[model samples]
Target chain A: MAGEIKCNNCGLDNKPGAILCEVCSEPLEVTVGASVPIIASSSAAHTPASAVGIIGRACGLVVGGNVIDREFELPKDDFGFTIGRTDLDQGIIPDVDLTKFAEKVKIGQDVGYTVSRKQAIIIRRMGRLYLRAIGGAKTMIKPQNTDWKELLKDQEEEILVGSRFRFGGSEGYVIFEVV
Target chain B: MQVELTLGQRYLPITDEAEVIFLLRLLRDSQKQSADLALDLRKILDRSGSMDEPADGGLTRIQALKAAVNESLSLLRQGKDRLCIVVFDDTMKVILDPTIVGDINAIKKLIDGVRTGGSTNLSNPLRYTLEDVKPMDGSLPKIIIFTDGNVNAPSAAAEERACLELARQANRLGIPFAVFGTGIDYNEKFLKNMAEVAGHGSYFEHVKQVGAMRLRLEDEMENLKSVQDLDVRIGITAEPVVEILEAFKYVPQQLALPVSGKIVKDEFPGLDVRGQAYLIKTKVHAGKAVGDFKIATIALSWQGVAGAGVKSMNVVVNFTADEKLISPVDKTVRNTVLNTEGTKATLSGQYNRAQTLFTTSGNTGMAKKVETLAKSDEDAKRTLRTVTVTEANKGIIGKKGAK
Candidate 1:
């Protein structure tokens, strides 16, 4: 068997080729390019920044706010990234912390408060980049030179490089691009 | 009629689950011109109460529909092209039987006064249109139904079965049947399936706006006049153990066509000048033998004024152990298979799956194209699904415009 595959989320060793971790249920392998959990959100005690296990080409989120985690990497076996404003009481931190970019530039306010605890998820299904929005303030795509369109709740929309995604029409918007 | 077959890969995999893809293109030898067509067109409108709701620009759906119908009536050639109108709700009624398009004012008045009532029921109208397409002047027979709600006459199942069976009858009778779903609540799957079974037909659209519906109707008429007047039933007969699996259409439009009973109807005037193709994927049990094996046969039978004829061809595949002996895969066939699967995934609301499939098949263009479609209304997606994909099972999916 391939050496004990460690779960990125729970750090438990899972059997080789097991799709999910035996303890945390986080994905154990990169299935369809959308790997598993790299790090939890900044909700509870930060699980040490060393926990981020980037396994492939990483992308960066460019936003106008107090800088935090701009470079987003995926653990080879990570399932997907859960992004939101408040993961504080949720116990688990999201892969991409929207609050990280919420600090107001001048006033120094946590503008991420406008987003829900679980605003949306960016996952790879069948080798494609997909965004599934589920927050109260529905996510909308602000395309270059095109009118902003809403991403229906629970329905997946294709996300491409250079696409600007506004979460809940808040100041915390993400422009995902391959760096 | 003629059929041409192209294979994605000439060699089959040795042991694993093997897929054999064959691209079958259908063609018509007739040189009929657009000027020679004496057209016969039918319109089936749903007068269910929902259609009376206000649409764009303060116009109710029925008013928009009447204006659209009147606009279509003006496009007719007075004494040359013929037309008919069928209005239905819980009960069915052919407001205008098959008639010439000269009396435009009377027809417009009749269309304007179409009262909205009851729920949607399609079976009766489908059956009535099938019976009314008589005196088959040899003009291409096409029936299009516009509805904004679910079938609720007696039962949804009964209505669906009646319409589907009637659609099959339309295929046999050389009548092209199409359905346009105008609202969000209409059953997308049922309408899509109905159009598929109808062979030479199409389904879907947000028929609320008068302009969109007008263009659609005009396009349909122009296509009817330009393409060859023929109806065809294309079926595949394979060895019992050899699975005749799903297919993806390539030439005419990129669509996933899941087949059943090894049969799919393709009415003539299909993809006319551009041609039509369905890349059929099949699973075959092959030994390590390095030789050619004929596994399936394609049968196509068609009837028209020129004459009726049947064409059949055997699908053959070669098995080889030598890696160098395998022929390079046909990119057209490969992309069709993948893009079709991508379209299916998109229809099922799996955008990433579709994108991955498209990218894998080297169809990055299609991958980018679907993103825009992804953000559009349900009506847009449904239109793409039924119009392009349903034609694979059985529908007359022609080019965007007449040649």
Candidate 2:
């Protein structure tokens, strides 16, 4: 009974020694007994001989354009990560680098704007992944067999395999695939 | 004012549930012994061109509005309430300065003389009420705007933004900006957002019927008389791992959660007496181990009627989680979540989703779910014989062609 912790947000009582809230997925700060084991299994926990198995167990993004083609491997960390262009002077290095494409292109009389500096963010919660738009730019997500949904700024949607996303008003698209 | 706080659930089972809803009911003790609070009330009545069109029965829309305003005016305490009347069409006109409610003849004369003709311009009267009318010392200042048409001038988007901004400003100044939309032609979304931003106000929908409209206004006036406190704010302090998903205020409106807070402090505004309830959805991380833990402490602060100093109350809940103990879900909390979520889905035009949630929960009665859905969806009305067209017209009626 001493191990049980109540969630402050939803007022739901949780079993003693829970690290994350059962209801809201919030982190529980209560200490657990020594016998309690952490439920989450990370890639770092693998033995040295099987460490190579975690190499390609990640989601990747492919950005293709008329003259540009690039690939970026998403972080395997459980936490949420940002995807945008890098700003070295400001010490801003995004999880998925797109700095090479963050420029205004001019070909004859046509002009084009690049993806924003803080374009989109992918968050993993309770083993589920979600994508959110940042910097007020429009981000559209198209899941397989579903129409594209405009991911409004700050609105998060779950990402699935075969899902594609485009940022701003640009023509380049990023396909989400497990590699 | 005395405050009583109760939570819908005190125990939750440890599981992988993504969201938990806790319903907080704030009940104000009877204040019959206290004298009526002094109030500075202003009424903004719309007299647009459409007001001349015939409503249900033979009465025009303006005629119905005038009748309702007159009946509601009689309910205000004569000496304690000071009233101002403003009429608007394409522009706003101040027909009466601040006058005592005891002067029924003068008020009635102005109400009878209100004429209908011109495009609907909602921003002018709202701007005037906020900028020109100064608040009386020790008296609650409130502006009630009644309109029956969409705001058509100065561009709809610009007008909506201005109205919302004004509502926010009025809220900061402790002025309640209530808007009443009559008939099906008005922009309910704009009015609802305006009332919500005003913090301590609400948006009311009145069917075009004159008799029902009068009764609704009278009921609103009666409710206004029971104001024990105004402009109430509740501050919640939670542990680092807890996340608040939503906060709802019955007096003002409902708010989707995570409600703009940093790590330690989350604030919910626009609360009032007359028994308001807030359903909060939160998540608590199961930590490394289970032990007795302090979840959250809620501090509610409000200004009592009659210019009483700000009063505060603190409610703290603590629980211990043990794997051996089986925790039954709280039905009251569960029902509240179902109802709130159902209503939210209906308002957002997700009728099928709302119905699916209702059916899956099975905790809420089918009749109640149908009634809730019928409040916003016309299609749902076909299944419920008791639901009237007017009742079904309560929610946002987007633009002419919008879904």
Candidate 2: deviation at residue B185, Å? 3.1
Task: Give Cα distance to truth, residue A48, candidate 2, Å.
Answer: 62
TM-score of 1: 0.60
TM-score of each: 0.60, 0.59
The list of candidate 1 runs beyond 4 A from truth reads A1-179, B11-18, B28-37, B91-93, B132-135, B153-174, B200-210, B239-241, B248-274, B304-306, B320-323, B362-365, B375-403
lDDT of 1 by residue, A28-130 (tens): 4322221111121112343332343322345555556222344765322213446666432112234466775543432354232455555676654223445
Lowest summed lDDT across 10 adjacent residues in model 1 chain B is found at: B394-403
Candidate 2 Cα errors over 4 Å, as ranges: A1-179, B1-20, B31-35, B204-211, B262-273, B304-324, B356-403
What TM-score does the A-chain of candidate 1 achieve? 0.51
lDDT of 1 at B253: 39
Quantify all predictions' global Cα lDDT against the true fold.
0.58, 0.54
Residue-level lDDT of model 1, residues B336-382, one tens digit each, is 55556666777778877777765665444345545555666765565
Per-residue lDDT of model 2, residues A1-179, tens digit only = 34357886677777532333578644344421111111212113322323222233355555451213335544232224466765432223455666655556554686644665567776542234567775444578876568888987546776655556766455443444434
List the TM values for chain B, per candidate.
0.80, 0.80
